[model samples]
Target: MREVVPWQDGPDGDADGPLTPSRDGAAKDIRAFDGALGPARAEGLLSALELLRADTARGAQLDFELLRRSQQHTLDAPQPPPFRSLQAFTKGGREHYGIDPTTRAHFDACQAESTTDGGRPLPLTVRAARACLDVCFFHPFDDGNARSAFLVLVFVLAREGVELDGVSLLRRITFQADDPQDALTLARYIDVHLAETRRSAASLGSQ
Candidate 1:
């Protein structure tokens, strides 16, 4: 994430259009998760959707506070959990995320890349995909890191004035830090979804 990948930009890859709301893919995915695997455990994500929209409107920077707020409802804790201090393991201990003094800072820097810096900007697909991967690799949350990763991906796109009508391609997907192809694959998958979303919205508009 600190080294943002220059994921190739394709025609109309950015989410500057079809801002019109259509089907809520993220919410639908969340609802499915809530109903089946998690029950109300994923309810926080529903609230996070509202938070994402509100934060996007205010142009809030993607940081730890936003992440903390995203988890408040799910954890049912009045006090939001702090940045995870100890190491985090996932995928049945197949993955281990280490932490130290600079871990949170590194995560923050990765979040900052969601916006364009002085350098050339990455495609929205790349940025969003990167955010999703960063959350996965960093494993910032004590629990529900996957949920947070999903929200971060949506938040990154929402920041760029794009909203997907369908997120089934992205929901529940995991990427490996060791695999470079996974990053590119994610960006491409996002491209596919974005194209479909634009087409879907255009069709709805014409009807």
Candidate 2:
């Protein structure tokens, strides 16, 4: 079952700011994620994610207007570009998801080495989610750090056999954290929360 995206609250219960995903050209790749989707629908989802990412990266906050437009586009309505950006993400959204220039360089360098040095890559859950979080937090590219971080977690969880819905649990944790120190606390909260929720849901056994 799909789970809601997590992490949108802060200790004060006031959001730092809105978050938006950059539209830096991940639309094509986004389609790849939806293997079961019809070609047209997959294309549309990719476009939406791209637009969302673009607005978030540049503005470092959610573009409610862009997101709304993207959703409308998904519904097959004629719409303007959901958002615009200066560029597209490398390896889809992987390159631009985080916040720092130098850190992004290091990540790309490591990824390059991994490509040829391949043994087997780390499982997506273990490696990618953490990677995304590290970049999102450290790079601080002005916006969408939490959302990008959550997307990485979502990808990892999907690889680990979890189906994520729209709400990102990790996103909520990040939003709730007081600062960097509080992020560790949020991580712990997520582990316990998800495990307990799963257990409870399992006990219900499809009613």
Candidate 3:
């Protein structure tokens, strides 16, 4: 959903540091893989992004169930797609994600934490990065778990009103769930792109 809200002005808004979605980094990543993944994946990612943006724009809480809509668009997800009960192995079967009766419950708990804590909350960057990794490591959906992870990252940032114009560092890269540095690396990646996006936007606004 491409939104068109009046500028946030007449208040203590930054004259040059206004966050703008100037370009769709998620869509760009999908397009780059369209030749291999096809148009359905593109449609799924784009539509899912719309859902995420719309919900965040209206202050809706983040929910994993909403992501099934996008997963269905990208791939043939079973009706209401139940969470996987079997173990999932990714990264050429090197990394294994096990599941039990409580897996779904754990996932929901993690998603609920994606929002602010309202008391000594973690920085938005860490929360967003961890949210992305949750989907990656949780391997929630039977398929498209990577795509789902990426979307969740975007959703987290969108909830905080941040969008990047480029996403080269965020996509198609594999991270280890057990690696201590992976989360830090991801947060750093998001921070780097975000800083550049703000810089580029400010430069454009000045011209």
- By TM-score, the better pick of 1 and 2 is 1
Candidate 2, residue 90: Cα displacement in angstroms equals: 24
Model 2 lDDT tens row, 20-110:
2222213323444443557776665555555544543454322233334555545444654322223334334445433334554454443
**What's the true lDDT of residue 54 in model 2?**
53
Give candidate 1's error at residue 121 in angstroms. Answer: 0.6
Q: Can you give the lDDT of residue 185 in candidate 1?
A: 81
Per-residue C-alpha lDDT of model 3 across residues 1-207, encoded as one tens digit per residue: 001211111122122333675677777777786536687667766777777778788887766677676566556445556678799999899889999888888888888887877575656667777788888888887888888888888888887777888888888577887665667677778777777788888888899
Which runs of model 3 end up more than 4 angstroms from their true locations? 1-18, 76-78
lDDT of 1 by residue, 137-204 (tens): 98888887777888888888887778877777787567777767778888888888888888888888
Scored by Cα lDDT, where does model 2 land?
Answer: 0.38
TM, every model: 0.90, 0.37, 0.85
Residue 108 displacement (Å), model 2: 3.7
Worst 10 residues of 3 by lDDT: 1-10
